[model samples]
Target: MANLFLIVLAHVTVTAVVMLLWLARTYMKLKGELQVLKNSVQKNDQYLAGLSSSARAADSRLAFIDEQLKGLSAKLSAFQQNEQSANPYNAIIQKIRHGASVEELMRDCSLCRDEAVLLMRLHGSGPG
Candidate 1:
């Protein structure tokens, strides 16, 4: 009876030691993986800091470009308005320069296609 008890005790002790050894190895592997994760996190933090500042600078440049586009749009609109405003007087000036018969020009009073054609010819011919 005594010998059987001792044998059982020995078996339990050996099993416990094996379990402890496996748990210790698993703990070491997990600790190494945790260190690797910590290193990656640190590197990401530095990259983000640089990226954030560059993004701010890009936002500022975009604002300036937007302002320039708006100014260009306003100038284009004003130029169009001026062209329309000057059309009527410009047509009369062109007619006079054309030397279209004064009688015909006077009769039309409104001055018309004949004067414009004559004007283009006069301007295009030069000093005639």
Candidate 2:
């Protein structure tokens, strides 16, 4: 009877030892997987942070471009206004805007007939 009890106890102890070893192996695998997941998350976070900063820099560049465009538009508007007020082309346009006829100005002016006609066309109003 004493020998039978010792044999049974020994079997139970061996079984318990095997179970502890299996649990330890499973715990190590789980810990390795958790570490890998944490590393992936950290890398993605760093990449996202860099991307956000780059986006902000791009936004600032776009704003600068927009300001330059507005300044150019203002200069263009001023140039067009000056053209309307100063150029010979503008004088011709204004004469044409008034009611004087191109043919009449050519006749009265001493310019050669063809030259008169050309000048009249250039600076005088259309026949009306």
Candidate 3:
């Protein structure tokens, strides 16, 4: 009976030691996986930060372009108004549309020969 009791005690001790070793190995593997996850999260955070900065820069550039477009629109509006007020070719256009000759446009509208010909091509009654 004493030998039976000793044999049972030795078996229990060996089983407990094996279970503890398995627990240790599992803990080590889980800790290594946690560390890898942490590193990946850090890299993702850095990449997101860079993207955020780039987005900010792009927003600034877009704002600058918007301002430039507004300025160009205003300039175009002013130029269009000036062109409406200062048009010098209305009479020449009318004469060309009425089938006036290039020589007549040059003589009456004080246009050069090339200017008369170009006007005829653009606004004349006949094909040019």
Candidate 4:
């Protein structure tokens, strides 16, 4: 009877030891998985931070480019106005306003007589 009791005790002890080893292994696996998750989250956060910085820098550069384009556009607009003022037709029209004759306009601006006559009529003070 004592031997049978000892045998049952030994069986329970072995079963308990097996259950403890299985629980410890499960705990270690869960801890390893948690560490991996933590590392992944950390890496993602760093990547997001870098992206945010890059986006800010890109936005700043785009704003600078936009300002440069505006300045260039202003310069281009002024140059176009200056070019319009420099047109020979504008000078010829002024001369017509000051009462230059059709014959003089035709000679100075290389206009046909018909064109010169039109300009003289449009801009000249009176028929001549």
Candidate 5:
């Protein structure tokens, strides 16, 4: 009866040791996996930071381009206004194209004689 009791005790002890070894192995594997996950998280953080910096730079460039476009739009408006004010005799030129005489251009456009003759020479169908 004493020998049977000793055999049972030894079996339990061996089983306990085997279970501890398995537990230790599992803990080591989980620790390795956790380290890999930490490295991946750090890489992702660095990539995100770079993207943030690039986005800020792009935003500044876009703002500058917007300001330039506004300036160009203002200049285009001023140029259109100047062109409208400068060519008040477009109707008289069209009339001259239809063979209107210099005297007719002077009468219709209220221009001086020299201005009418110049328009006739420039836009008329034939020589002034």
Candidate 6:
């Protein structure tokens, strides 16, 4: 009968509408989740970039420190060479500190007795 057919048609239309609404809600939830994932990935990329920059800066500083140390080493070597060659008094002081007598200092260092006596009194470890 026509009445039976119309009742069946109305039930089908209501069921289809409910199915469509459920599908739309599911789509919205999936879209929100995708957005959250994208944001997390962007933050991770920024953090990695900052770490890379810091590592490069540290490497540069280390290189500068290495060059400064090399320069200081060279200057120290030159100063030592100059001191050894320029100062005979350094050797005389070593002899005096080792308890050399005035006579030995005068004979070996070509110093006058008065000068030898004065050095011994000033720098000798033992009795002058």
Model 4 has a clash total of 0
Clashing pairs in 5: none
Q: What TM-score do all the candidates reach, one by one?
A: 0.63, 0.61, 0.68, 0.60, 0.67, 0.55
Minimal lDDT window, size 10, model 1: 119-128
TM-score of 5: 0.67
lDDT tens digits, residue span 1-128, model 5 = 99999999999999999999999999999999999999999999999999999999999999999999999999999998887679987778779878888777778778889998887778886545
Across residues 5-69, which tens digit of lDDT does each residue of candidate 2 receive?
Answer: 99999999999999999999999999999999999999999999999999999999999999999
State, as a TM-score between 0 and 1, how close model 4 is to the true structure.
Answer: 0.60
What is the lDDT of every predicted structure here?
A: 0.74, 0.76, 0.89, 0.89, 0.88, 0.88
Model 5 bad stretches (over 4 Å) = 90-128
| Residue-level error in angstroms, candidate 3, position 100 | 14
Better of 1 and 6 by TM-score: 1
Clashing residue pairs in candidate 3 (N, C-alpha, C atoms within 3 angstroms): none
Q: How well does candidate 2 score on lDDT at residue 100?
A: 43
lDDT of 4 by residue, 1-128 (tens): 99999999999999999999999999999999999999999999999999999999999999999999999999999998897778857888888887788888888889898888887777787545
Q: Which stretch of 10 consecutive residues in model 4 shows the poorest summed lDDT?
A: 119-128
Name the lDDT value of residue 48 in candidate 3.
Answer: 100
Model 6 spans with C-alpha error above 4 angstroms: 1-20, 88-120
Q: List the residue pairs that clash in candidate 4.
A: none
